[model samples]
Target: MFRFAMLTLVAAVSAVGAAQAVVALDPVRGATALAAVWREGAPPPQVQDRAAILKSADGHYWAEGEIQGRPVRFLVDTGATTVALTQEDARRLGYDTEALVYGQKVLTAAGEARAAVVKLPAVSIAGASVSDVDAMIVEKGLETSLLGMSYLGRLSGFEATRTSLVLQP
Candidate 1:
């Protein structure tokens, strides 16, 4: 009876230990966390050491920051009439692009497609604050999104000085 009880206790302890394994999510270290899981030998993400944050000489602007603790690279594009993101980036932001109200037909490099318009409550760039910024969450196979005039135009002044874009809001 004593041996039987000890065996049962060992089994229960082993089961509990197996259940407590903790899996870690490293945004910088997990490069293909989105792209692959089943595939073999995906590269590990190297955390970026931003030397200088990006700002544009053009009117549009964005600051590199964490979205759900992941690295994001943004560009200021005044040429783009509206704020836009590729479909994949939107998904990373926890947005289902297909379900959002796609309010416009945009002329993209590929072709015309439905684009969902969204307003970001707060977007800060280089210690500057801009609120209620009109933005878009794009859907799949995206090159990149342009932080465009729709958001930048609302700023007090967006100008190109010598080396940097001056954004006054």
Candidate 2:
């Protein structure tokens, strides 16, 4: 009976450790603790170094990010091959739009638009940063700044769910 009880205890401990291991690997580490409370009716676990989580509203995941060391809101877009900025956003980031050479013709959802291709000194999101990123400044017809592969591609990984997006830096 003693031996059987010891084996059961070992199995229980292993199972608990496995659960924590799985949670540790999650992109949004805080979600693990939140999920534990939601799933197992336990208290929320203390989370450290949690990943930034963005919830989708209106079918888009928006995030707060930094570009050129300035705060900007981003529309996380995996479809975009490179980061795209609106003329106003570029100005907000202290770019001289009048001097920007709009020589690149790029096709957009709004048809053909002339864009200025520029190398960003650095782009950071959720503490992960990439320097010398290629980005395009759309002079017209684009509403929001896009956080594209130029930035997202630098991360170790990111995960998307139906209602939320997790950025791992």
Candidate 3:
């Protein structure tokens, strides 16, 4: 089942050179596909500039990234308009959470939440990188930090398969 899903995803991604279509799967199929991908996931060998493959994790695509010279974990989330972070995660990434000015109202599963806008110097995933990213610090209702369009929209393209997500810088 997992292998089949991976192959399906790979074929879809390769066809368009972007995974935007893969993410459209219904929740159950999406989750299954993600699990299969992560089970066999590994970073691409012989790293190339602005190109890399990321495997899914648990039911989501995750990546080890850097912000402000500190390592950070990111949950790839295209649904999110901008990079959204928990205050705790922001602090860990060296952002002065206490100094942040929360002024934006955003909707979350938990209800309305406030967010603080901030600029990230740079964020790198595997060998590809993007700079001057716009992000938001949500004080609550968010369980994980997300790498959203603020970063993804900057990419030349990205593709997804049941087994992996390919990023083009």
Give the number of the best model, judged by TM-score. Answer: 3
Model 1 lDDT on a 0 to 1 scale? 0.45
**Candidate 2: count of backbone clashes, pairs at least 3 residues apart or interchain:** 0
lDDT of 2 by residue, 18-103 (tens): 11110111234432110000011111122244345444333445666678778766665554557777788899899999998987
Sorting all predicted structures by lDDT, with the top scorer first, yields: 3, 2, 1
Give candidate 1 misplaced runs (Cα > 4 Å).
1-71
Report how far off residue 126 is in candidate 1 (Å): 1.5
Superposed model 2: Cα runs more than 4 Å off: 1-50
**Superposition-based RMSD of candidate 2 using all C-alpha atoms, in angstroms:** 16.1
Backbone clashes under 3 angstroms, per model: 3, 0, 7
lDDT of each: 0.45, 0.57, 0.60
TM-score of each: 0.54, 0.66, 0.69
Q: Candidate 1 vs candidate 2: which has greater lDDT? A: 2
What TM-score does prediction 1 earn? 0.54
| lDDT tens per residue, model 3, 67-158 | 87777667665544577777777988877877888776655545456678888888877767899998888767666676777887687776
